[model samples]
Target chain A: MATALENANLLSRAILTTQKLRISVSKTFNHMKDGIKVSQDEHGAPKSFASQLQEDLFLINESFIELEKLTMAVRRQREAETIGNTGALSMDPVTDKTPLYPKALETYKWATRLREHSAHSQAFLNNSSIKRSSGSGGSPAKRRKTAPTNLNISTQAVDNLVMNVNRQFHDVKITKIQLNPTVLQVYVSRTLQAIIVLRGLLIERVLIRAHHENTLNDDGTLDLWTASKYEVFQKITEHATAASLRYYLPTMQDLSFRSFMHWLNSFSKLFSTPCRLCGKYIKDNLPPTWRCFRTVEPYHECCRP
Target chain B: MGVTCVTQWPVTENRTVPQAVEVLTKRLDALGASKSGNFGVDCETYQSVPTNVPLKYIHVMHNKEQPYTCYAVTDNRTCLVCENSFEAIMHRLNGFYVPKKTARIESKGTRYEMGDFIIKIGIVSLGPHARGVLVEVEYTPCVIIQDCWPLMVEFMQGFMGAQYTPNTHPMLANKQEVPFNAEDTVFQYLEQFENFVKRGSSTATVR
Candidate 1:
């Protein structure tokens, strides 16, 4: 207990030092100058901040897509394990591993590759004379019709995958499925996914900003991180495993979802009732912070990061 | 993420002017809130929340290095730079202040003043439709007590009645009335304050 308290004190001092440094830097920059307001973001948000945020999300998005695929792959692996003379959940780590499930590796790689496609697409946009989408500025009914497609990885594949995965893992659910002739994105959540995003720092920023946004403002603007972020992350952290954001970037870092999950799962046992919100078997009592009138299977505050 | 950081300022939702009237009526009964009949405040349908903090003044800033902090005509950082800097401060005022615009300044009556700081009250009124007018007042309040508005920041505390009072942290320190820092001459602050009022008036329409 004394060590924990000492650590907390040290952390506070470190945080204060950083804040003071920023303050000191700001103090130095004060000098009289004439200026003009030229245009709205005529210069744009500090490019550095925007680029970092965009890069992080791009990799995370791929990581999530891969994690979705891995959930299915694991179900497939579990199927093989079930049929082989082993107990339902049991698989021989050394010999029974087989070929690392070719589909899982493919899914992981595909997830990691998405960042590259995004970067190339962005480059293509900048290189060409085409302007970014300001808005469609037309009636929705007048939009272009869909093109034809013939492929096994059609919308049907997603539906089948979701059905198969959900049948095996009752807690998991594919919340959204998006399909384009070219790029496809699927959003799946089972409480665990949201937690992974939070662990990656997305949810914390969103929630902190949301808390500061006062609801009393006359303007009809909602804070970015309402109760929903905590709810989502806490739920995901408890139920899902090896789920995180993943994407590929040709010119940048390629974050892996499975790898992050594998990393996170190593620590999941620390949370006493991980995925308490969605898990079928969870004790009734919940911690004060995580108590929700909405969810019957409540997560403990201690379990949340 | 929120589309814009500025848009997400804290505010109470769904307040009616009549609610303010009722609240004021109750406020009168509250201890130390002027219970005398003469001490009552009247609202001109001021039920809705003002877009900016009440009594907040803007200062001009022109500092070269910290442009955000310098040359701003804001008297206090919080009054001008705080979240709700662009909103109407006072919806209605019973006391009429002389408009700085079109008001003649005499060369004789003015006393020698190199650094004697004065305040400026920037106001916007709904004149003949929603046309915005930025009015500046040379905040020469008759008495120090009349200067109810102060920079919305942590300034030195003054005695309420000769007793020392401790200001708590997270106490919305900017809301209290206090004079400018003694070390930082009042004249410099006033100059900064004037610039704030001008910028606020110009930006009022867009904001």
Candidate 2:
């Protein structure tokens, strides 16, 4: 009677542990589904995605180990009962009357399947590569050797590029170019104004406002953050940002900058240019807001796609 | 505030004041202008009391577009753009400048917005009598009149008929290169108000 009670307790404990393992496994899967972002915990400290995932996995491993131990004990108890009853009867009365043995076997099979699935998931996760840092993979000495030759153009090079572009394009005027986190203000004809921000040699941000709209704040400094008040110019700003990405070339910074300026010069006819597709000056009460990057033809937002 | 052009929409032989406004609104609706709301611009004439100082008229004006500012244009054409608190200062100067009760005139009607343009069709009135219809168009993006005048004219011609050529407002003639502001807008309204007063109840001939 005591042994039977012990078996029942072990079975219930195994079932509870299995439920915990299933929950933790699903939790890990859910976390993986949503691309991991560094989040803050209740204490306001930044908790990393990898650490959270590791903790969940650890809980699942503990539950699996406990369950395996319980299943082994249950199997040993069944074996002992069968061996003791071999001489007394052909088959155990309790085993025949109840479906306990079959149920135990089925539970064991289910646990085995869960274990296999979890192992496969673990292997897949281990093989998947995620970029976690900005630094290139190398030792400190090797990194130091490569860092000096990085693709960061000097201020003089940027200035020379700007001067050359200004000379090439009559309408494209680079009014101001400031260094130490480079900023360039280019006035394109009387149509629009553009402000370009650079990180090292790369163009990081671009803002476009109308010619009449003050690109300066009340204090007479270049306004980098405020969006254009007019919707037409706002749409142009979006297009210019895309152009910056299209013209990006790390190896040849000067050529990339010139290409971007050339693309922007197309907008000198922003107010006058009619839509190429619809062949109308105004659609949906807005003048053609889109300009093709390659062809420089104007199209209304709806007419573009 | 961008460059604004305020002109009288003449009340012709066939159309009355409200009828002319209706025609204009219909034309604007057809041109894809959605009615935004109603706007009113009222001007109160104040004359300095006959003292040692010369008698000068100060037109204290309020435009619904610029709710927080008061525009006071002196007879010399110099405009003082100040906070709404200037109304209290005007009240305090009651002994110096006396308000002309009968000269209180306003232009009030529907306002419409089409893309970058704001169109206001207002009925000018003095006391209880309707005076005329004044149409004001504002290109809200471009501040320089010279830069956007052609564009404004093209847009205005769409609804005002192809033959309706708008001469630049007299107030904006010298301000073509200057950045237009709320003062410029209100000064134009004041000019139209003075015209209505001089003409009395006679309908303005379309120019």
Top lDDT prediction, candidate number: 2
For each candidate in turn, the TM-score is 0.16, 0.62
Q: Mark the 10 consecutive residues where model 1 chain B has the least summed lDDT.
A: B1-10
Q: Candidate 1 residues A1-305, lDDT tens each?
A: 45455555655655655565555444333311222223344476443534544544555455455445434433222334323443322444554566444444466579779988999898787566432222223333432321111122355554454455445434333232223322211122211222122212111111111111233225663323233333323343333321232221111111232233233333222223334544421222221224322232344445433
In the order shown, the candidates' DockQ scores are 0.01, 0.24
Q: Please report, as a residue range, the 10-residue window in candidate 2 chain A with the lowest summed lDDT.
A: A82-91
**DockQ category of candidate 2:** acceptable
Poorly placed runs, candidate 1 (over 4 Å): A1-153, A160-177, A180-235, A242-305, B1-207
In model 2, the runs with Cα more than 4 Å from the true position are A1-150, A166-181, A189-191, A199-202, A211-226, A245-251, A266-269, A272-283, A288-305, B48-55, B91-96, B201-207
lDDT (10s digit) by residue, model 2, range A186-259: 89987778889987656889999888667778998767899988877888888888888777765466677778
